[model samples]
Target: MPRTSEPWRKPPKAWKHEPGRPAPGRTHEQTDRRHPIGTRAHEGLRQASQGTRTLRTGPPHPMSTPFETLTALRDEWQALQPLSAENEARLWKKLRLWWNYHSNHIEGNTLTYGETELLLLHDRTTGNHSHREYLEMKAHDVGIEHARTLAADKSRLLTEGDIRDLNKIILKEPFWKAAETADGQPTRKEIIPGQYKTTPNNVRLPQGDIFFFASVEDTPPRMAELAAWMRRELDSPTLHPVAFAAKLHHDFVRIHPFDDGNGRVARLLVNYVLLRSGYLPLIVRTEDKANYLTALRLADAGEIGALVEYFQSLAAQSLEWGIKAARGESIEEPSDVEKEVQIFVRGQKSGDPGPPPRTPTQVRELILHGVEPFFRILDQKLATLSPLFAETGKPDIASVAQKIGLLLRSTAASPDYRWEKRFDFFGYTGKADAPFDFSTTIQVAFEPADYRICCDGNVLKSLRYDEMLTKEQSEHLAASILKAAFER
Candidate 1:
């Protein structure tokens, strides 16, 4: 017996193309168009009912929901704070200097650990600098002093035990406020008898009834589990030091074992990992807090691809800034490549017909079709540059041509493949002078689901179709085609 196809399913609602842009239904034209579609369909029935009229209304805007409001608040907070290159360079220098100084002090060169801790604690507690700034100041103070007294002291390198001890010492300070239960109960806030002398003040969460002891939680067991996972994943002998450091930083922050000061400790851990692996310590500035948080949040949500892309971008920016600082170049606002990518994505689907479908193949195809024009143009430019391959030390023209052929063949072989034309010239240089510089976009979609495909600023196709393919099959085929087309 032939298998019957399931009823066509609608796509999951796509994110509004532009950040902060209201949904399309709120637009006057959209509402008007929707009314006419329903009204025209029931015109015969209305005539039979003696020209009766019925107005249609939708549910109130979901933006008023508490979760939506909180999400908006988070977005606003992220937008209000941006990290700039100049601040990042300054912070990096400070951290390096402080690390050197502290290493020397710990090695009994001149300053003692107690004195270093006092300086850091005072600076941090008094708000002499922002939390990130204070870290930079303390690290640099230590690094500079270490260089002056023991430039060749290889023995001063910090061990794992030293890191643990440092964390303990830092937590012992009264900088972090502890959390309290939200029962409105009044109790003595002083240190209890036989309790550790280094207890911190307690505070309550904004919305929860739970309490948190500053930097003191039952985290050892969790930390051990996470560390075991890390050791297993990162034990490769040939891993690039920078990549390893980035991964470690991401994993540590995700665990978030510390009740307070996790950010500070995570930054230090990244530096320690990098330094131990022969890379310079990096200073992620407070000014870059929005971008940092965005990356971390995305990672926490299991978007590993997006997080890796963010890290690659951040690493590149840090390196470029470091080079500029070394050459005495003015450190101004760095170009935000991540922002550019986001803007490009938002612009591509700003006026989508509606939400996308749920089937994996449909979703994959929607994204692929949306980005197809950009890839097509990019491929064309690469083809034009094929003649300079030998000079550029890249693959030969024949190999590139062969790869393109394979991509075209694979795309043509797919039953779900569809092609559409789109105009996209945001970053194009030569085409600026051309009158009709529209590009060709190929949209490949699966049946059995409804998908909305848009490119540049226009909607191409919006329809409900059968879902004829699985997600894994779609991804495997799509990846092969794209790899052949673009990687060549």
Candidate 2:
């Protein structure tokens, strides 16, 4: 077992170290028995992580590091100190669920955010999801739970054992799975929980190239070096927490230590770093995966600024959410959380070809009865607009009105849309259809004076304009509103 010969530098000025007098500096060769020589198997990592410069001392000062900019963010999170334990617990739970969902989803875990929560919180399962997905979700929850435990215990420093334990949690009981070879041959690979890679692995590049990891033979020593680097950085106190986490993630992926679950373990450890520093965990949304990968690629090229900045931004955002939750404010749940909750509770399948179940019969009846007369009147008035709609081939405004009216009628009657109880005023109910989410809401609200046509409750137009629309104009307006709402 070789050890790192690199000398330890002075701790960062901002961070506190032991109060005793400085000990005599010793050569790394004296410590080589404990720390081993970490071989750089991936040529790119040697260039990217270790610059070409030959240094007489340790790496550059914390001030010169790319993570220095994260100081303000870290300070902001700390200044909101003394948060109630209840608040911390609530925020932590919310973040854990979110982080678990996104991280697992990125790795192709089939459980939706809702299903993940249902399994974790309610001990319930909703869909006919695969057994592997359920186990994956369960394993992630265990890993996060362990991270939280470690984060709360200030005395526990991160160790190689901890890293392996996280990997073990992620892999759980391993089984045979399909894997690709260096040249892209499909093969069955056996995974050993908590163990390093037994075979070579390569990542597929967007441009049809392969990015190979450190050789399997080098994984053990590289992991030793990583543990040493982590301890050194954590003790230094100058490296911004986010940057430290980012660096750790980058180096771990560069090593690609395990045959599987390396990415998942890397991300979990990133949050582990943040949590240990008294900061909230960042949930890297699956939607930002492309940008996230871009940041990593940039870091792999020896340009770490992008990855650091990305981590800082995500950390700041997560801290804001934590603070809000701690203060008893209603933090917005992830869009997936609400959507998934609805799916399980309401039994509405995702991507269902059929319309969602209809709203209550009373609500449907109200919409149908109230919309019928106006539609009839509009149908009669559309005769004057024949010339304007000639190209439509429907011939006249009545035909256009009829077609559009039918859709609106059907949409309002569907169970998939919801009725805003607040807008119900005897005749019309404010109804909405959030196809996937609140990003796009097709709405119909009954106003005091006239009906409002809207998307997500933002009124686009009023059905009654000056109370004097020409017959043809009325027909066109009605048809246009219906088209916009249904098209969305």
Query: In candidate 1, which residue ranges exceed 4 Å CA deviation?
Result: 1-160, 169-178, 182-218, 229-243, 325-488
Residues 341-391, model 2: lDDT tens digits: 554544454543221222334333434443333344434433333332212
- RMSD versus native structure for model 2: 16.4
The RMSD of every model to the true structure, in order and in angstroms, is 29.2, 16.4
Give the worst 10-residue stretch by lDDT in candidate 1. 3-12
Tell me the lDDT of model 1 at 65. 18
**Candidate 1 structure, TM-score to reference:** 0.34
| Residue 370 lDDT, candidate 2, scale 0-100 | 38
Judged by TM-score, which candidate is best?
A: 2
For model 1, residues 21-56, the per-residue Cα lDDT tens digits are 334765421332221112222232122122132111
